[model samples]
Target: MNDESWALSPNTRKPLPQLIEDKIRQLIDSGHFKAGDRLPTEPELAQKMAVARSSLRTALQRLQLQGIVEVMRGRGWYVRSTSVSDRDESLVIDSRISDSDLMEVRIALEATAASLAALRADDGELDEIAKRAREHQGASTEDKEELLQTDEEFHAAVVKASHNELLEQLYRSLVPKLRGYRRNSYGSAELHNRSANDHNQVAWFLKRRDEGGARTAMTTHLLGLYNDLATQAGTAAGERAELNTFAWEDEPRWRDR
Candidate 1:
């Protein structure tokens, strides 16, 4: 593999860690690092890329979150899989449930949580929610894992503030199932910024103890996310169709049987 082909060049507009991470992805795409291949040691990779060790580690962590790489305890980081479909399959629990189905349940629970939270949350709970929202907004784009974590924390706070044990328990169980979809939905900077703004609006309504306003804001945000996910899925399907048309000219093996 030619190191020059995957060289990391610092961009003024993007974080250094992000640049490094992008280069790593390019390496994977170019066959420099195949699935199950062990990544170079931290110091070696950092020196090779002419970047700080910390920056390289941060980049690796981002890839890990995306399921591109996996760190084996006391062993080292290795490429998990190059294909997004492979990674998605591993993250998803049930093949029967679609993204739309997940979103339907999430919207109902989140809206109810927001409404109840507005009615029940005290000043302290509102303060905690605000703090999480601020953290999410301040997070850098390269730190998407942290951003997602804070976003979950903010929602969890809202659920907790609702003071409904059954609702809280149900939401908690659904969270793990939604992790992959949530990450995909919030992948871009634009989406993240929009979500943060939506969260602020919900927080504002909660602080004012306006149950209706909070519920409406939450509902709108979740619905927007669902639409975005649907659009993305459609686009991806189109791309796959184009690729298959060109690459699979002959009928599939099973089709002839």
Candidate 2:
């Protein structure tokens, strides 16, 4: 790719990372870059685009999150196979359960669980949640299975810390139902990073014994996942608009208390 092709006007509205992301996507879409092709090194891309390495990395991370490219440690970035084979079973889980339905129940259960965990979890339990969060964050994006495993463990640790056997039991029962949804939503590197960050926030609050903060953090985290899944499900425009605004945006009833 020519450096001139990457030149952006000072008046450009988008952030540098987003601009670079769009440029790279265009290149891939136009076949200038194809599956299995290696992208230029970070230094080369930064120089050619006249952007900082950080910005270039952000763009590449976004691409990786979109499954457009993947990174191999010690090697450069490579475009990944986005093609769906006829035998693809990525979404072959129980069709009776919709993501929104699952998320609705999760928000109710896990948010309360997070709050209870903040009040009840001992130092060791809190440390376990923190450890799981860091493990998920450090897990390589190339290993989707490991990444998802770490994520699940992190959530499981949080629920277990709540010391509520009923909540834990319900959550354990729901775990199998969540596997397909996890595979569907946790595809990109960016989403993985976001989840890790949210987990960190949840852990932070739990450690501080901040019940409200823990609950809010957990709710916000799950809401983000719910919104992502809803958007990807291709709802109508009006419904999409509604879905974008979460119910929590309204004033909390407890505010009057």
Candidate 3:
């Protein structure tokens, strides 16, 4: 390994362990290390990065959570292939869904959930939903992933509150896809705030026991997301076509456009 290239320079802003993890990911992506390649010994890597052994281990553990690397007993850390196929089964299924299609199904299911929740949700269920919404609203910029998780929890709470077992099962099955969408679109603080506001509106209607209002609120929120994603997809398609006219030729000719 090239110690000079891999070495981490002094930085005060971000945590040292996170920086180390980022550098390791960069190395893997840049082909400095390939799948199944064993990482350098902990002490060696720590010396190279000018960090403590404990810090290096901490970074490695973070990478392990991300599926970027794996630790072998009595051995060492090895690079894991960061391929789409390596993702969770549900996430792999999510990858196959178009944004528009997923949004359509989500809108249908969640609007119904909101309507039912307004009528069926008890005080306790409403309180749980409110708590989740509050947590999401209070989340900071550094808590983007946490916010996404909270967003799902809030939605799930609403679905559960509907008291429809089949509806809840269907919504649970779509969790992975919903998570993928939120993670992609909720990267910006502005988007996060917008989503929180939408959730608040839905919760408000449900709290008032206004089923029609709750359904409308949920529908409007999902429709807004669908429009945004559709526009983004159209723009990306146009840009890719303009940049490379032959880009489509690389794919299976039999595949649908």
Candidate 4:
């Protein structure tokens, strides 16, 4: 089809699901939307992409199930996975389950995660992990903001350590809401320090290419952090950042990449 013809006539080639999914993914990858940023409503997205609302919803549901996007009861979908926000944010597993039950699930999920990562992590991804850790190493105490940023970096790496897309996506969704809550109300450094050593040890293990060590270290690391945070705070305050406060970076990470 000619270019104008194609633009004027609805796309008749690709499946509607694939079309909407690709458009949404492009918007995300292009930095038109960002991690934690809410997407346009399903109707809006469908109109923007020229697809049926049902197809758009299906695409969003797929993204949500895959962990790249998250759906709140009335809030709509948000971008969840990214290199920066994932760590600074704390993890929040969805549940009616008790902390103990969640811990068991984490053990099974993260252990297998490390094993797969040991085999799958590419050199480039590993380098990214190391870079974030170094950012943590030099983070100044006076730089609470930087420290918070670095802390997120560190956890984001561990989530990355699993080398599984779903794991990264899941942790991304959970961590930010968790961390944002802590930052908003109590600002608990004592609670954060409690988990730093485990984070350090896990980072060291992954760097060493010790699969067994990585698996065990990460498992314990997450559980300990979970307990420490759980003791301090169990639920997000149900707040969101003011638009001016965490303004979308004018030049975001993705534009050049």
RMSD of each: 15.2, 13.7, 13.8, 16.8
By lDDT, the best candidate is 1
Q: Write the per-residue lDDT of candidate 1 for residues 76-151, one digit (tens) a residue.
A: 8899889856553344447577676677677788889999999999898899889878988887777665776677
Best by TM-score: 2
TM-score of 3: 0.55
Tens digit of lDDT per residue, candidate 3, span 1-257?
66678876567687677789878887888888889999998987888888877557657755654456766656889997655355232233446767666776777888899999999999978987888788778776575556655676678778878998677656655665565566677677788888889889888988999987788788777767766877777845333211111235431111122
Which segments of model 2 are wrong by more than 4 Å? Answer: 1-95, 237-257
The estimated TM-scores of all candidates read 0.55, 0.57, 0.55, 0.46
**In candidate 2, where is summed lDDT lowest over 10 consecutive residues?**
248-257
- lDDT (0 to 1) per candidate: 0.74, 0.73, 0.72, 0.56
Superior candidate under TM-score, 2 versus 3:
2
| TM-score quality measure for candidate 1 | 0.55
Candidate 4 ranges beyond 4 A from true positions: 1-108, 142-144, 181-194, 233-257
Query: Between candidates 1 and 2, which one is better according to TM-score?
Result: 2
